[model samples]
Target: MPANPTLYAYLRGEILPYDQAFLHVSDLSIQRGYGIFDFLKVENGQPLFMEHYLDRFYHSAQLMELAIPLERSALQEAVFHLIDKNNLPLSGIKMILTGGYSLDGYQPVEPNLMIVQQPVTMPTQEQLQKGFEIITHEYVRDIPAAKTINYSVGIKLLSQIKAAGADDVLYHQGCVVSEFPRANFFIVKQDDTVVTAAQDVLKGITRKNVLEIAGRTFKAEEGTITLQDIDQAKEAFLTSTTKRVMPVVKMDGYAIGDGTPGPVTLALLEELLKLEKHSAQR
Candidate 1:
């Protein structure tokens, strides 16, 4: 891997190198995980569907009672600045909005803005073709709809999931399947219905697009999915800004359908890719 290049971080209106973008040690976002953020895909040099991501980010920040000091357009420009500064071909951009510095440790201030641009690389074709196996965990997220930083349980379970020979973990409370560590989950039925959780999970951008397109071709529903639902699924996959539409052939030592990517999953992938390609060109 190329040595991680130095990337720029924008704080308030100031641009600083990564190491210089420091937060107060007592910031509530660090002490209590009181922060909200968003991620989006950057192709060539532009962030794809950035406005949608920013809208959601602002919503999450507002829900958490944090104030963004910059306009959405200003934030988008900051991302472009980092892209050019780092000379990145493909990248992932993130903006962290937190209840800024507090000497009292609990007092709130205007949100601190931290923007980062990092190199983007995908799993090799060999890795994708082999498919990823996932482990199911019993952890649950608090205020699941908000993209906050209090992700202790999800972060803690990753190693155990990887040790179990899986690329990720699907957290389910008893029969209720919530979501993956950082992606949304989906399952296909023999009848060609695509099902995934409606709430208590991040409403992924790719997930939204897949549902919109699937409306024309196959049955798609956003409702509660359980471990039982996934175990019994005819096909399964996960979606995210990075993963896009990925096939999950197994979970927790059990084969998903016939241990292969299913027809519905492939069809949605093809359709989603075409839409994204067209959107990029526009």
Candidate 2:
């Protein structure tokens, strides 16, 4: 007999067994795919940059017209309670707010909130040095500012991505480059200026940290980047909560600056790790 599962989740106002956390079929999140979510990392029992994550979460709820049932302080307390119950030292915390159950299944009602904690592994140095490849797709997300649950297009392109021998897809509009399905894109210029798309992208927490770290050693700015700009760039990378800083050595089957992680990417990754360590200690 296998040991019983011990994982737990926070649903509505109660902390319950993970498997018992459920939402009705009439929820707009299920019927209309209306919802928003935010994820943050926890290290050594400390949630990193929690306030920043909460700020984004509340902002997303407001944008989606979904009201969070709990106050900010109450939500924070619930998160901590969930963390303590799960007791996962190194993990990722996912906060999900969904359109609640509705009789008509077309209009917004009381929103459902759920939080889950799961173990996560950080990337190794070898993996970072080897980097990964990405294929380009000409599509953009709906409501790119809010962290909505509508990843239909990205999910539908999984086969295409794997068929092309790529790890992910980079979305673009004609020649204008935007971002990856789950990460924000960045490139290094010949003059060492770091640039990422300024519009039509979800501003990721890790992306913000990278910009701040890069600003100390190089010129970091957000603006429009096109395929032509990437073609002439010296290096490329992507950032997200899970990926941290991942080098993009190839795009659309072409080598990006020797097809390996560059100095700028590696330096930024080191500084990011340092920042995560310091932030976790706080």
Of candidate 1, the 10-residue stretch with the lowest lDDT total is: 1-10
Question: Which ranges of candidate 1 are over 4 A from the true structure?
Answer: 1-6
Candidate 2 lDDT over residue span 2-73, tens digit each? 222698888888888887887879998999999999999998778998888999999999999999898999
Query: For candidate 1, lDDT tens digit of each residue in 1-282?
Result: 333437676776788877677787777888777888898877786678777798899889888888888877787777778777876778888889888887677888767888877777876667667778998888678878888888788778878976897889988887898898699999987788888888688888889989888888889999888777776789999988888888999988989999987788888988988877766512
Q: Report clash pairs, candidate 2.
A: none
Give the lDDT of residue 126 in candidate 2: 80
What is the C-alpha local distance difference test score of candidate 2?
Answer: 0.91
As a whole number from 0 to 100, the lDDT of residue 72 in candidate 2 is: 96
- Against the reference, the lDDT scores of all candidates come to 0.82, 0.91
